[model samples]
Target: MRLRDHVVVVTGASGGIGRATAEAFAREGCAVVLAARREEALEATARECGKHRGARTLVVPTDTTDAEAVEHLARRAVEEFGGIHVWVNNAAVNAFGRFEDVPLEDFRRVLDVNVMGYVHGARAALRVMREQGRGTLIDVSSVVGAVTQPYSHPYGMSKHAVQALGSSLRQQLYVEGVKGIHVCTVMPATIDTPHFQNAANFTGRKVVAMPPVYSPERVARAVVKLVRHPRREVVVGPAGRALVRQSRTAPAVAERVMARQTEKTHLSRKEEAPATHGAVHVPIAGEGSVHGGWGGRRRTGMRRAAVAAALAGAAVAAGRRTGRGAPGC
Candidate 1:
């Protein structure tokens, strides 16, 4: 379905890819409903979307993990912009550490927000879309869903579940012959988001080691493209997409490489200094700096360019290794 005249609801709209995606849809002339826990941030995103000229936007401070809140978000979007045409499940959290070292509560929180949050949005959107007989459901999964690393068990598990959820939902849709309704999963590499810093970590360090980091806008743009044309899955970046291909071609080799990488990667759980209110910094942007500057075309363009460059570099290195009949020399 075209975004120009459709209504879209985006969870985790306060920052990162969600914020970028809301603006993207608005630029496409889609009326957008932005939802997240932070009201002020959501308002800021809404204002940015409003600046885009073609789209009308609404902000709903919503915690997507809350079923009631998600239901309300869906209802409000319909009330304000007619029926919902697309729903993007982008809310997620991370907790890095050995499974035993990570607290049970922390694991639960991540699962609730990352896994169950998708479920909540999917359930709510499916209800309205099925009634309307048309809709698109977009899920932001991760490369971890396909190949996991050490110390990221909770996050990986959540992503894997989300992938399964998307797969199952798509199959169910086909069985029901739900014309015009689509579900898709987007798996990306380590995004340059604050997930590393703000995510609950048992190691107490900042930023785990991931060779290439893509910007949130890279994934955000993919979401926009997917909404325009739904697919079963879209893996963002050449490196990430290639890894999925490699996994299918040589599962054992991919597994060994990932296991070695995970073993060598650093795991930091160091807690940031609490603010005056005793709240830790929420890692929505990224550790150390926000790559794309605030919200803008130039910054977004630069971020995507950087990620594309990294992807190209990785691909060249991988190709060289393959030519040499070695994984890496």
Candidate 2:
């Protein structure tokens, strides 16, 4: 569990949470392997990681959807670093639109990258980890996986599948009596990452993360912690935790609230963006960064107020129901 000199492979290392996580591991003195479809970006991330003394890095341009490519990525990590201690599956894509409005091909592409990509990475990592007798596999899911959202049906569906996939893998591992191999899922709230901009758009409006956006570094920190302390799942950010709690406690209310909030704030009609498939089928060329420039827009007060109002409303409703059943006193 100690990270110093440990070999870690991180998929989707070119940008967003993946890039920040690679840097985090490097700071822990781990030999990091950066995997993504963007060779130049991956190399850039590798250079950043190399800045840390005693930390080595390998850049592997990989399309996770390709089973062979993912396998090769794993082999290269073992061949270079001698072994893999932690594998992080963070590669994913999204399409924005109503379920019917989104093209079928685009929807399939989302599944291929978000769901199948994680599967391929897990399979390859498990093969190496089982041989090594100890390794941690981390899959980056989302709060949407637990609670549904509007205008992002494919993404939500894929994340749900990711949660199920991790659970199933863990169960099988337990049955096989596999020791030292751990599967963990990290579900984050709306993160201030390039995802909104990179996602394929069909809504015509500019996409934006909802209020109370958490920095990608927050999720990156969580991922690094999981390296040493593996758990079944970890939800990043207070907003995400609140949403998950609400979903579990009041499914109908949560769904209705989320539907309204998503439609109102998730997309902006002021700005215009043309529809594009994004990186679903091809690599986006750039040396991506960790932050998505939404820091100034974070509405922490608004988020806190919303949570308080919801709690108060729930309490009032419960009081009303109790009063209705109580006899005159």
Model 2 per-residue lDDT tens digits across residues 1-329: 56897999999999999999999999999999999999888988988999998899999889998999999999999999999999999999999988888999999999999999999999999999988899999999999999989899999999999999999999999999988899999999999888888888898888988867887888988999987788999999887899899999999988998898898889985888788887777777788877788772255456668889999999999999999899683
What TM-score should be assigned to candidate 1? 0.82
TM-score of each: 0.82, 0.89
Which one wins on TM-score?
2
lDDT string for model 1 (38-85, tens) is 777788888888887788998898887789999999999999988999
Q: What's each prediction's clash count?
A: 8, 0
- For model 1, the stretches where C-alpha displacement exceeds 4 angstroms are 263-329
Q: What TM-score would you give candidate 2 relative to the actual structure?
A: 0.89
Error of 2 at 327 (Å): 44
Angstrom error at residue 13, model 1: 0.9
- Note each model's CA RMSD in angstroms: 7.3, 6.5
